[model samples]
Target: MTFTLVVPDLRFSRQAGFNPLTEMALPGLASLLGRADRNQLGGQSAEQWLRGHFKAESAGAAALSRLVDLPAAAAGHWLRADPVHLRADRDRALLFDAGLFDISAAEAEQLLSALNSLYAADGFEFVMATPQRWYVRLPQAPDFHTTPLSVVTGQDIHPHLPGGPTALQWHRFLNEVQMLLYGHAVNDAREQAGKPPVNSVWLWGEGPEPTGLAKPCRSVRADDAQVQGLALAAGLPFRALPPAFDASGADGELVLLDTLGRSARQGDLYAWRAELERLEAAWFQPLLAAWRAGSLPRVQMILPGDEATLAASLGPAERWKIWRRPARLEECLVMGS
Candidate 1:
């Protein structure tokens, strides 16, 4: 599994406030809400108590009022009960979970549909990489996206979140996936720290197949520095590329973003499977080489699929950097697999 991510700084953080509602979707709420200090209900009932608090908001409460739409209406009460610091603008938003899962193509399509409808009003640009992966351009920077130990999971999301399969379950599931993709050493770090997997949020981001890795591949085309910085922090080496463009007879500059793999949406597993194979083979060699050399250096590949899988290979401590630039794009064929 692999994906892409957009890394923003603090300026981006101020643009978007913390979205705690998504946090509630995770498994353990007691530690997050500081319920161990509260004398009311023991920490065990924190989830239920938190939900109740958000449900009791007065009609037309301040900025919080906007969050209540029948589904989230219940949360209003919780906000009223346990008032915490909140700001109008958010901090940062990242595009992730791209091509990092094993979801079927049809399932990916349904998930994307739900995300498009749910966040349509936000005016974020949606870039489709494959049927399952995508990138969202947000009006505000979301603070939650940059967490070191975050989990993003999406199944068919037409009905409601945290329904039968809770967000925490998805978080745990993704962590397991991360372990499978990155290696058990990644999970070991979290366990040693005595902290539950860190960044756990259940919701839809683009289609289910590509998940969140698609867009970062393009964004990395331009901003390799930030991506490289993240990779270095994760104790990985960053690989540099030559150029991505050609002067030969070409059909204009098919801006990589516009040429996203194929027309296949999340619903088309057939196309996704073929593309995935092509991508893995292209990227695995370099990554495997890096691993063998004991330098986990981030390598740039021409295929978005390669970038997605490479991203998935990173654990909470690992970061994959994608950059765009003629200098950054190179001919994978020249490597001579």
Candidate 2:
């Protein structure tokens, strides 16, 4: 059987001082890295790569995620209208995604209620899937495209906001929402308690019902709503990522490991090290043992980073490649590019 592991922000380096990422004692990863046939895919996002794998290049994240997240959102053109925080930095406004902050169910309810009431007559409805994920269902899908919330996180959002012909119109919508959410009771309470305000919504991932999606793997193991949505759209079985790597049997399975992303992006050195260690202990070590014992045949690793994506293929035959040089973990590693 064939197994594939997809991880984001794995190929990365520290900004300064000791680079714990390269120093991890991942014997399995090191062995595979040395033996696997490696290649780089420049300028491609891990999300986009998943879309390509599932042959859903035409699909939008909103439509894909909605299939799993907002199932009641039937018969509608949808867009991911996620809550965010815009902070005034030195020269530009940085977009802080919902993951960077916290919002309780009560806060989400209060915030969405005010928003829904204000826009009830505007030909759309605001639906909250989770505290962080919100959606806008429309009668017809818009023609413009939008940046994903992940891509916009911790970056200047001036150029990433709604673009295309509807730029002015959506810009106005953003301004109006900011005005409405400014100093609301929720924000007031949040500021009083020392938390970031739920001040704005980042509009992105617009989509019409994603069709013609093909299942590329036997099953999908992922924590991402968008990935699960894609699997569901393609009629593939889906499961959440377990604590460790156990294929538990699939002819070919697609597993997404993205937990390392948050700490890596935040540049939390010790946290990053700890998460990597967790992966090494839980996944890589066991995987190597199984593969060496011939329980698994072929393995594929997809490592996505800011500058490029790396693909490494491994097989039993690779064990015989004694002449292969030791792999450099930092070869494709680049952080915060």
Candidate 3:
């Protein structure tokens, strides 16, 4: 069988003052690295890499919404609004993703209702696919560019806001939405309950629906909406990632493992280490055993980051190379860094 494992944020920031691998022991990961053939897969954000895998130029709000069976407009552009925290300085506002703000479906509905009523006259409507994932359809595509949310979390957003002919209009609408949300009763209740109020929305992934996505693998196993959406759009079978590799299944399966990304983004090294160890035990160890037993023909582990992707392809023959000693997780991290 052929299995492709995609792990996002597997590499830690070199500037974090401490090495991430030093905090954990990853025997299975180290063993895989020791025997596999390594290559660089170029540099790009996780979203960009995943988009290319599906042969999509842009797999943003509209493309993802399409996969979830949402209605689309002929000339509409995706106006994805994510709840965020805006810290205002003397001259600018620094935006931070409100990662801890857990909104319920009821709360999301209430906020979207207010937003829809306020922007309906402007030919904008809000659609909530989930409490945290919301989309808006615009009458015309905006002549502007937006930075992906992954690139701007916990950073200043003023420089990354939309830019071009329709930038001013989009900016103005964002400000209006902020003011409206700031005064809404829902936010008032949240603040009273000591929860971070749904203060503002970050508009991004602006584009029309995607077309002609490709199916690179026979089956897909992942929890990411983008992967699942691409699979659905391509009419491919998809399943949630299993707890362990099942070599008894058919060949050619694409598995996406994303536990590393969240903690890395949050700068939680402790959590990152714990998750890595868990992955080693749950996935890497089993796969390694299968390869040794000749039950699995090939396994490819792909580590994708904002800068670059590190890929290791191993087969039974490669695993038998005892001359190559298992490298520490730190050594592999340096190659990626």
What TM-score against the true fold does each predicted structure earn?
0.20, 0.94, 0.91
The models' CA-based lDDT, in order, is 0.26, 0.82, 0.76
Over 4 Å off in model 2, which ranges?
13-22, 332-337
Rank order (by TM-score, best first): 2, 3, 1
Clashing residue pairs, candidate 3? none
Q: Report the lDDT tens digits of candidate 1 across residue range 88-203.
A: 22442232233333334453344444445654675533333334333344444222212111121122222222223244654553344333323334224544766322222233
Off by over 4 Å in 3: 59-61, 69-75, 88-92, 243-250, 335-337
- Minimum summed lDDT over a 10-residue window in model 3 is located at 66-75
lDDT-superior candidate, 1 or 2:
2
Worst 10 residues of 2 by lDDT: 328-337
* Top TM-score prediction, candidate number: 2
lDDT of 3: 0.76
| Candidates 1 and 3, the one with greater lDDT | 3
Which one is best on lDDT?
A: 2
In model 2, residue pairs whose N, Cα or C atoms come closer than 3 Å (at least 3 residues apart or on different chains), thus clashing, are: none
Worst 10 residues of 1 by lDDT: 6-15
